[model samples]
Target: MALNYDEIVGKFDKYIFNTYTRQPVAIKKACGAVVTDVNGKEYIDCVAGIAVNNVGHCHPAVVEAIKRQAEQLIHVSNLYYTEQQALLAEQLVNLTEMDRVFFCNSGAEAVEGALKLARKATGKKEFIAAEHAFHGRTRGALSVTHKEKYRKPFEPLAPAVFVPYDDADAIREAITEDTAGVILEAIQGEAGVIIPSDGYMKEVREICDETGTLLIVDEVQTGFGRTGKWFAREHSGIKPDIMTLAKAMGGGFPMGAMLAREDVAANFGRGDHASTFGGNALSCAAALANIEVIKKEKLVARSNEFGAYLMKKLKNLNKDYVKEIRGKGLMVGMELSIKCEDIVGKARERGVLLNCTSDSTLRFVPPLSITKEQLDRTVEVLDGI
Candidate 1:
């Protein structure tokens, strides 16, 4: 028998927290860049679970890894060591300049870990973050996030100073003896895919160095080859003292991590911080497969090539409603003078799924495995809208 969609919706309304203004459709299954609703209508997915499905939905290798690992082991907790966890940590350390890693279960947890490390390492009580930046919803993370609407309801957050994004001088001015570190997203995904100016990251690195402040880069949404690189900081030619990662790390499973320089990471003692389910056998195995797929498939280069194609095609449309098109790799955004919520609904009706962030920016974060033909179809639908 078919599932009762209305009954399920009613149950959700009755029991689930009213947090998200959910889309009308109910997704039942997904493959590659396409998702099917309960009624069997298919749509090209451009959100990619908000950049979590970097290897694409239900990737065979990741699925196999999960199944195999599940059959053998799932969670042993942080009380014991697992080879899967150690291997994943080694891979991350080798991929970047960081020397140590801390496993967590979500982007917020990773950010929270990084913040705690910063405070402990620097012995400072304050932090500096960028305006229009989003870290996470946890208390420590929320203290650094810039949006007033999200921060207002929960006032008197942890002490943090805000600086204008992409402005090196403002960061320098904001730093003080009490400031523990400076945290910002390399590419602000929630702020509508906002890309920083050239040399901005490098300048921030220099400022942090001069002021004895740790530089923390949040790559939760822009990592795992989503930006055509292992991490977006590569594009800026700078290595942060610490990096927060999640979203796509576990290839659809829940996982997160914080990589830090050796000296700074040593600030955390054995009992300082930990998670019960973090670095479990299953999530680590899935993450390993996800990284392998990105490497074997060479999806990083593909993201760059196809992303340029997408931007070029979107520019050619020359739609009057579009004010600007910007992004790197598969993380593209179309900013409009008018609100884009209606455009998102219209595009969904036309069999394309798009996300509108910040009210007027239409965000597109398609899977790295998406084909050019699929992109062409998306553009054709947008043209009609």
Candidate 2:
């Protein structure tokens, strides 16, 4: 049966929480790099659910894995052990070069867990975070997010000091003796794909070591091949003491995790922290399959190559409006001198999908499986817009 898109949207407006100002179109189906709306309008999905569908929508391996896991066992509470959960944890630990993994449900939850670990390990109350950093939406994560508009409503947040990004000296000044952790995104996602200065991460790593501050890298947007590397921090040749991952890690399923070194993870004993549905069998299966597909297809390397191509094409659009083109791999951003909301809407009307961040910046987080032709089409639409 076909869905009544307008009717459903109207009903949603009436009944749903007014949290998001949604786009008018209703996306009903997606495969590979394309999505079709309920009105039969097809689009080249450059957004990729803001980088969630790293293997593209419904890769056969992931779909089959989900089906098989659903038939076997959908979920088992954290009280009991499951093969899928253990296997996923082991795989993630190995992939992240970390000693332990804590499964949760979303990026915010993983950030929360990482925060808890850092405080417990260091026995400190304050934290240091980068300016324009976006960790998550929960209270603890929100405290460090750095954006005043999002934090104004919720005051008296955790004790976190904000330092200017890409500035090692600012970080040095911010990390006091009472600071438990220094957390930041490898590449600023919500702040419009801002990459750190050269050797910035190495400096951060060294400073954290000196201060006994746990370096927690938030890879929620840059992980799982979105930034062309297995993890964006690898591009800088630095390993964080703890890492928070979500988004593409579960292949569109709801799953988040924190990977930490053995010594740091020792802070949390049994009954210290737990989630009811964390590491469920089905989510674990999806994550394992997603990792397998990412490896088998060499999507990470492809992201690097194709991302260079896309950046080159975007540079050609450096007309009166575009101020800068910056990014790592498929996580590209175009900063405009003016607001980009209208341009994004115009591109969407022309059968291309994109998202805006920071109002004036346009973000392109295409699926890792996106082809050159799709990118060309997106470029053409953007050029016209």
Which structure among the candidates has the greatest lDDT? 1
Model 2 lDDT tens row, 42-140: 999988988899999988899999999999999879989999998999899888898999999999999999998898898898989989999989999
Candidate 1 lDDT at 182 equals: 96
> Where does model 1 exceed 4 Å of error?
none
TM-scores of all predicted structures: 0.99, 0.99
Clash-forming residue pairs, model 1: none
Which ten residues in a row are the worst by lDDT in model 1?
1-10
Against the true structure, candidate 1 reaches a TM-score of 0.99
**In candidate 1, what are the lDDT values of residues 1-385, reduced to their tens digit?**
7666797798899999998899988889999999999989999999999999988999999999999999999999999999999999999999877999999999999999999999999999899999999999998999999999889999899999998898999999988889999999999999999999999999999999998999999999999888888899999999999999999899889999999999999999998898998889999999999999999999999889888999999999998888999989999999999999998999999999999999999999999999999999999999988
- Local distance difference test scores for all models: 0.94, 0.92
lDDT of model number 2? 0.92
